[model samples]
Target: MQKILGLFLFGIVLLTNIEAKDYEIKMLDMDKKGHTMVFDPPFLQIQPGDTITFIPTHKSHFAQSKVIPDGAEHFLSPLDQKTTFQLNQEGVYLYVCPPHQMMNMVGIIQVGKAVNMQEIRSALPKLERKAMTNKGRFLEYAKQIQE
Candidate 1:
């Protein structure tokens, strides 16, 4: 009976240790081209167990998950609405706008540790593909040009 009780207590501690951080992602004014896309801070730095809230003032904008080089579905926002998602692991999350991918309406969420832009740049192909698929042909061409 004592052993069972000890195991139960250990489980409780493990559960308590898992916590998530919350982030508020806001979309502000558009650029010169009148793109209704935006992301607060543009880039976010956070640790593991963090959450990001995407609040878009404009109803037409959307967020969606991008495709990582490893064939993973990175966090993506919905189009024309507000959304939120929690970061459960430590890694680089690349997100972009479904409508303004060409304008580079992109954002990054770094969790667990620090990630340099160079690392993210190296994996541009995958990111570009993911962006182009959601945004449009213009963004696809734009991503290729950057590389």
Candidate 2:
């Protein structure tokens, strides 16, 4: 009976995770909005366990995690290559392109609720300071975080 119960529980866990989804983001040099060095659709809302593929639509862009929820894994993709990141933890995730960071090549991925919004918010000032061209752009994305 004990062994049977353990197997049943494990099966239920797998079933719960079956609904996870996948998403995509583009690393762009310039978008229709006339912005440079940015992620197309710079802000994304997703659920925990979702996966995101960062495609380099232009060049010299990689998805590098800047801030993540505590216990969440950090990811950094190769520059100018397609890389996929799995978001397993719940909270807000911030990413940037190292080569064009000064041009404000940044983005946000909010998983579930903004469970770690305060921590992500506290880091915005530094992100803003590090930006050379698009001042206040980081905070602008942060403001879009709901709850």
Candidate 3:
């Protein structure tokens, strides 16, 4: 009876577990929207514990974390390589493609909630300072966040 009860409890645990979701962002030379050196779906909203896979559909573009909530780790994937990021922090994340950031090749990710949006807001000017063109795109993406 004890062994049977343990097995039953294990089954219950498994059944109640919430599985993390997965998402993908493609690195493209140019998207249908006419943005160049950009990540497809440049704006994303995900719950905590979700995973984002950045796929380099075109060579020479990579994803690198630019700004994140305090204590969140920064990441940089090799150029033209695929990388996956497991986001457990409940805040905003800003990522960019180094070579093309000047072209406004950037992305925004809001995890769970924009907990640190205020902090990110303060840094937006610096982030956009590198964009030779399309600097206003940052504000455009920022506004997309409902919070």
Best first by TM-score, ranked: 3, 2, 1
Q: How do all models score by TM-score?
A: 0.60, 0.86, 0.88
Please list the C-alpha lDDT of all candidates, in the order they appear: 0.60, 0.87, 0.87
Report the Cα lDDT for candidate 2. Answer: 0.87
- Sort the candidates on lDDT, descending order: 2, 3, 1
- In angstroms, the error of model 1 at 136 is 19
Which of the two, 2 or 3, has more TM-score? 3
- Give the alpha carbon lDDT tens digit for every residue of 1-147 in model 2: 999999999998898788777788988878898887889888988998889999989987788899999999999999889988889899999988888888888999999888887788788888878888987778898778889
Candidate 2 ranges with C-alpha deviation above 4 Å: 1-18
lDDT by residue (tens digit), candidate 1, 1-147 = 999999999998787566555788776556444544556556676666667888886566666656332323466666656777867665666676667666456666666553333556665565555543224422333332222
Which pairs, if any, clash in model 2? none
| Residue 11 C-alpha lDDT in model 1 | 90
Worst 10 residues of 3 by lDDT: 13-22
- Highest TM-score: which candidate? 3
Question: Alpha carbon lDDT of residue 34, candidate 2?
Answer: 89
